[model samples]
Structure formats: structure tokens, C-alpha cells
Target: MAPNFSPDAVWAQCCEKLRAELPEQQYNTWIRPLPPADVQRDGDTTVLNVRVPNRFILDWIRTQYSTRLEAILASVSDGPVRLDISMAARPAMARPAAPSMMPPNAQGPHSLGTMGTALPPNALAARASGNYQGGINPLPPSAGPHTVVLSEQGEHPHNVVGLHGGQRRNGHPQVMGLNPGLTFDNLVPGRANQMARTAALHVAGAPGHMYNPLFIYGGVGLGKTHLMNAVGNALLADKPDARILYLHAEQFISDVVKNYQRKTFDELKAKYHSLDLLLIDDVQFFAGKDRTQEEFFNAFEALLAKKAHIIMTSDTYPKGLANIDERLTSRFDAGLTVAIEPPELEMRVAILIKKADQEGIAMPEDVAFFVAKNVRANVRELEGALRKVLAFARFSHKEITITLAREALKDLLSIQNRQISVENIQKTVADFYKIKVADMYSKKRPASIARPRQIAMYLAKELTQKSLPEIGELFGGRDHTTVLHAVRKIGGERAKDTELNQQLHVLEQTLKG
Candidate 1:
């Protein structure tokens, strides 16, 4: 029964308001065609409750439209109407007799859909039983025999041969192939990346069902992308047709720009939603680009609706995506997050030996260690260093000894070494000694500053090629002998004092890493 305030009329007005309130792309993604959730008058404030599909969508709405929502409600309602943004429940799965104790992953405030029926009863039961593991899914075909559809009721995994027949794309994704050998199996795991690798394996084995939004973060050259590809490969291996779509946040941005430019927004949405498995890399790039962030927020919800598995890799958690909308950040936090660290020395050595053997190069133990120790812990850099040494050895007909290896790749280390100028050394020492750079050269006779000043000089000598007089000049025109004395004292202390030695060792490692 329609109240004196017509529900359909209210929804129509709400839709119109949404169009006026949001950007065209956003309105189309979140509001167009989707009817308004039931509107109920609660007290003086009619609390217009809008059921959002997922927290990501809900968050995006709140961030970009919360204020507009209140105004929209104000226009439709008798007076000011408070907005109750919520994740609509699956109507097919009846509300539990008692309150359904949400699983750890579903405890978030947002739901999977705008209306309470996006998830089917079967999917809810599957989640509730905790017995069945949602296995792999096939890649989408173009209007093929078995097409997965998401509704609010019960979900049943459909197969081809008779059901919805979606066809496979002949050649849509024109992206180049990533390194075939960089899959998860090839990664040499150690303490630094053991946890991250394990999580990725779990995701690869169990797509959307295991980790709806699996997050892997680490510095550049870390195996973030490698683990992502490994999972993609594993998923593809289990289900060859698994529509595995991989793109960086930058590429996503490009797509957004193209779609917006060409007015092919529908095509863009279709292209992304069609993937059975979505793998996003360098998600951090979405932080600064608002339009790209909005596009992704929609793609995420649509895929989740179809039970499509999503794996994202980044240098920071969604929450840390600066310049990104808070709601988007919150949605990213809805999933399990794991981080990868730079490979440890042992891991690096194993990786090097593995690569060397693969390349038919017998890298000596010392050479391997030297390569592993000096180059950044990233596998790509490790491989590059190995290739350089092998090329030099192959062309010049010389074994890859420490000297030869050093000569072959002095350029890389040279720039890296040159970065730590005298000022940098002074600053690094001052930071370590809890002093200021001014104090290093200050006429102040305090031993506190003088001791640190000495270490800086010593590090400058070892790390940089600055002459003694040059080093002396950098230290406020001190005599060469004084600079030399500082270096010798710190060097001596490094040898005798374990703590001091450890600190020096750590500093040396930092300069190299």
C-alpha cells in the first residue's frame, strides 16, 4: 500500500535528485535503474534508508553524496530527513531466527547490495554452513551457455551446456603478457615474504570465496605483482576459462579516461564486469585520481555481486591511499590484508641461484651472495644483475668473480652510492646520534656531537669517493687529520663495541639496501 507519500514517487524523485547530485558516471553506476530502497518515516526525521550493494559503494555514496542525500530527502520528505545508509541484505536468505552472527569477513557495516536481495539464499547458506568451499569460476564467454547472474535470493553455481551461454572473447584484452616465469611457484619464500605468499596461495586455491578482497602490499621490487600473477595463473590453471583480468591502477585510470572521453561508459562497465577473476596491481595509484577511484569502486561491487574473485596489490592498505575517498578506503579494509617485505639475504641468494640455474649460468657461491647482497631484494633487479654479469662473462670470456661482477655492474651501485653525499652522511650520522647536522661541524666541543661527527666522516670515506681534504672541508673546514682521527676512532669502536658494531652494520646495510 502506498502511503500518502507515494513510495514510487519518492523513489523517482530520489533518482532524479541522485542524477542532479552525482557525477554522470557515478550516478549511472550506483543510481541509474536501481530503484530506491523502501522509505519509512521514523519520528520527526523520516530516516530515508538507502540499501547500498557493498560497503565500497555505500562509502562512495556517503563521501560524494551524503550531503546531497540529506538535501534530496529534504525535498521529498515533509522536513529534514536523516539518511540511514546500509548494505541491503539478501531477501532470499530470510533473516535468521536470531540475529545472524556475521562471519569475520562480513562484520563490516556495509552490505553487498543496495536492496536486501542481491545475494541468493544458497550463497548465504553456503556462507553460514562454513562447510563448503566456493571453488573456481569460469571466465565469461560472450552470451554463452552458462552465465553467472547475481540476485538477492538463493545463488546456485551454474555450468554451461544448457544454462546461460556466455561466449569467450576472441581477442579483447590487447595487453601484453607479463613475465611467464614470474609466477608464485618461482618465488623463493623466506621470513620476509612467507606470510604474503601463503595468503596468495590460499586466494589462488579459493577465489572469491576465500578472500573477497585480498590485499597484498609492499615496496617496489617486492614480489607484490609476482604473487598476484601467480594467483592469477593458479586460478587459470584450475579453471582455464577463468576470465583473469589484470591491470594496474594507472591502467584503470586510462580506461576511465577513455570511457569518459568516448562516452563508452557502458562498454567500460561491461568489459570490467565480464571478468571472472579481477587482479588489480599498484592500487595505490588510485589514491590521487578521483575519477579512476570511482570507476574501480563500482567495478568492485558489480564483480562481488557475481561472486567474482578480486585480488589487489599495493604499497599501502586502502586506508593509506592518500587522496582517495575515505569510503573507498573503508571498503578496501573490508578484506584480509597481508604485506610482503623485501626478500631477506637468504631468500635473495636462493632466488639468485634459482635464476642462475634457469639461465644456464653457474654463478659461484660468493658471486651469488655478492649479487644477492648488493642489489635490491626485488627479483627483477636480481635477474638484471645476474644477466649483466653473465653477459660480461659470456662476451669477455671471464668468470664472474667479485671483481668482474663489480666491474660489470658498477654503474647501478655508483648512482646508489653517490646519493649518500657528505651532507647525507652527516644527516644520517646526526639522526643516529640524536644530534643535528650543524652539530657535526659546530665549534661546540661537546663529545655528544663530536662522536657522531666522527662516524659521519668515516661512512663518507667508505661509501663515497670524497678525498680526505674534501671530507675535511665538508666538516666546517676542519683539518684533514681531525677528520681522519674521527674515521679511525669510529672504525676502531665498530670493531670492539658489539652495539656500536651492530649499529654500523645496520647503517651499512641501509646504504646498500
Candidate 2:
């Protein structure tokens, strides 16, 4: 028999259970936006309708979390209710009150406090309008001198100041420059970034205590920004009123320039110096800018004086930063520094699969390896290739297969396969001969330069698809006859002269490598 229950009460109880069971990101991504549409009965069977924003979310929840949700609902209603999670034709209106100005993304943060003070799903992103309209579970009136400023485009949080040169009265600083989606749970750890992730976790757990100035450096798209955001999100979860600020070094420089223009140095100092945590991305931009460096140095000293946590990211290690102030570089080196290396082949394949899972895409293992093997640059390129494949599949209305991926990334794969370029060949030949790379293309007729130049021309013909004319153009615009002669001479000598054969073989391997 179907148990009689109020739909609203049953859903409320289910949400409480799911929030406790799932990770915060999982809760936010799958469950938080779900609004109960209706409950009905088909003979003895009971059904619960929950509205979703799009087909992807509906399908994801159906496949991944349906069984778990069914169990939770069964426990709450004393029997299983057929969960009818569906995509709404239009936005539903039967939701809790929210600001008129919704965030760009339909799914935003819900300030539903803890278990005892759970609110409706519509309560999500109530702070979307730059105001924290907490109806049930409200924050304090003030958190020291920091003001709760809603982040813009997940960029830096604006530090709102009060009229009395003190804290704002509206709310405490719940500033979050971190993306809600980038959490520790979603981050896959491997040998490449394990130490960085571990240190980030430590800093998140005890900010300003252990790693006062945690510095993370790595190449592009290696998850440096993601780890920093994870730390910021963890800190926010721990202390809702924590004053957190995140921005790029360019943004910091812009702030300094603007403050100087407006003659508002005092306000700028207050905004940056009183933070519980400050995060800066791509600090390599801070190099060669004296005024910006001076301003940041002052703010850095001030924040340190107050024991505020500071985390920074860069493309290079601290000492590698050229033209920067020595004092600033010294401060950067004082704290813990961690580097995230490029992921290995296995790890790349793992990242592709994990990203596909997050996007609710059913990717075959072979197809993922195909994509991973081709795009070996960094994590960014791997994801970009995967995105292209997904887009092609969606547009062509086909499932992702090895053949489909090849067709999707045909141009990208061509570029990756031709790794040996004429310029690289020139450099390799010149370096092997212990001569400057310019000597390969120079008009010098010395045997040292001429032999290496001829070998480079031969490599261009063998290792690349360039025609003789094109090869000639690359070598200081010589005629195609000169290129053909060089290739013929090298071919004949490679078989007759043992020394030349060994050198040609070594040069070929170097060019390919």
C-alpha cells in the first residue's frame, strides 16, 4: 500500500539525508537545484516528480544517483516512491523566494545553513544580487572589518567597505573567488600533483597556521588554479564569515593603478591587508613592474603582520622571476613552495575518463586513450580535445567511438604527428655540430656550417613532408636544386663513409626525439 505523506515534508527530509551522505560538490551539483514538482499515485505505486533545469542534469541524476535517492526516499516515506526526475519545459515558479537578478549559471550556491536549518532549493544563489538574503539561517551582522562581497564571474571578490571606514552592516565577508565546482573531491590525485594537493589540503585545514604563504608553481593547465580554489572553498566551508579574496596578479596591479589614479590608497590598503586569506594567480606577471611590486610588498607585509594566509601561483619557480624586486622575491621564497609536474600517460588517460564522468559523457576506455595519446601537451589540451569530440558527437548525433574521435580531431592529430619541424631540425643539426643555430641558415661556406646545413636540408626532406622548393626557402631562400643536391650528396655519403653514416643516424634520431 502507498503511504500517505506530504510531498513538501518528504522532500525536505530526503534533502537532509542526501546532504549528509554526499560530498558538498555532489550535493550542490545534483541535489541542491532539484525542486519538488508534485506527488501522485498510479494504482498502488507512488511517484515523486522533481524538476531539473536541463536534459543533461536529468539524465545524470537518473543514471548516477537514482538508486541512492530511491533508498533515501523509501526510508523517509516508509516505502519507495518512483522518482520521476524530469526536465522542465520552462522554469518552475513554485520555489522559495530569490533575488530578481539570478547568476549567469542557473545552478548557484544555496545558503541553507546546516541540517537543522535546511531551506528550499530555490534558496540557492540568493546572494546572486550581491546581497545575502538569508531568510532562515542568516550570518552575523559583521565579521571584523571584512564585508561579504559576491564574486563576479568567479573572479576576485570585491571588498565592500563601510561609510565609517569600518565593516559593512549588511553581512560578513563570505567572499569566494573559488569556483563551486572545483573541490577536492573532483580533483584526481596522481604522482604529478599529489604533493601540491596534500599541501593545499593542509593549508585549507589550518590556514595561516602551517603554510602562511603557500606558493604553487607549475606549467599551464596543470591544475594549479583548481587546487588553490579547492583550498579557498574548504576555508569558506569551515568559516562562513572568513574574509577571502582571490585575483590574478594583473588584477592586483590594476587595483594599484586605480587607487593611485583616485588617490584612495588608504581604502586599498584596508581592503587587502585585513583578509583572512588572499589568493593570487599567475604571479609571473608581477615581474618587471616596480610600482605594482612596491604596492604588493606593502600589502604583503601588512597581511603577514595580522597572520593572514596568502597563497600564490606562478608559471615558474620564485627565483626564475626576472626583473622583480629582490625583497618581494625573498618573501615569496620564505614560505612553502610546491610544483605540479606534467601528468604521465596513465594519469592523462585517467584524467580524461574522470572529466568524462563529471560531464556525464559515456566514454569508452579505448576512445579515451586515443584522445589522451594524441594530446600529450598538458591537461588543458587533453580536455579541449575531449570537448571537441563531445561537440562533434552531439552535432552529428552519434556516440563517441574511436573512429568518431579520429574524425573529430583530424586537424589536431595532424599537427601533433608532425612534431619535427624544419626549424627544430636546423637547431638539432647545428647543436650536434657544436655550432650556432643561425649558422645553418647563414651564407657561411666553412665545412663546419655547410655540412650541418646540408644534413638539416636532408632531414627536412626525410623527416618532413616539405617539398624541395619549400625546404630551400627555409634555408635562407636557396633554389630547390641546392636542396636536391644536398639530399643526394648526404644519401650517397651516408652509405660509403662510416663516420658520416653514424652522424646521419644520430641526427635522424635527434630530430625525431
Top candidate on TM-score is: 1
Worst 10 residues of 1 by lDDT: 154-163
**On residues 1-513, what C-alpha lDDT tens digit does candidate 1 reach at each position?**
224665556657877877874545345545662546566766654445566444334433444455555556556765544556665563443432111212313422322233321231233323321222331111121242211112221001111122112325644442222333556556676656655665565455446644467777766677777777677655655565667666666777888999999999998887788777777787777767888888898988788766677778777656566887887776665555556655656677888888888888777889988887677436667788988998999999987799999989899778767677888778777887788778987888877877778888888887787899999999999999988898888877664343354456456556655
| Pairs clashing within candidate 2 | none
Per-residue alpha-carbon lDDT of candidate 2 for residues 1-513, written as tens digits (9 for 90 to 100): 444667777788989898987645456546765776477876665677676543323334554566667667677775545666654444434542121111213322321122212122332222221232333212222222211111112222223222211223234333635566666776777656755765566456546644457788876778888888777777776666678776778878888899999999987887787788888898889888898898999988787766677899988767778888888877786555667766655678898899988889888999988887566556887889989999999999998999999999988757545878999998888888799988877799988689889999987887677999999999999999999999999977664443454466456545545
Which candidate gets the maximum lDDT versus the true structure?
A: 2
The TM-score of candidate 1 is 0.56
lDDT of each: 0.62, 0.67
Relative to the true structure, candidate 2 reaches a TM of 0.53
Among all windows of 10 consecutive residues in model 2, the one with the lowest summed lDDT is 145-154
The RMSD of every model to the true structure, in order and in angstroms, is 17.4, 23.5
Q: What's each prediction's TM-score?
A: 0.56, 0.53
Off by over 4 Å in 1: 1-167, 170-179, 413-423, 429-435, 438-513
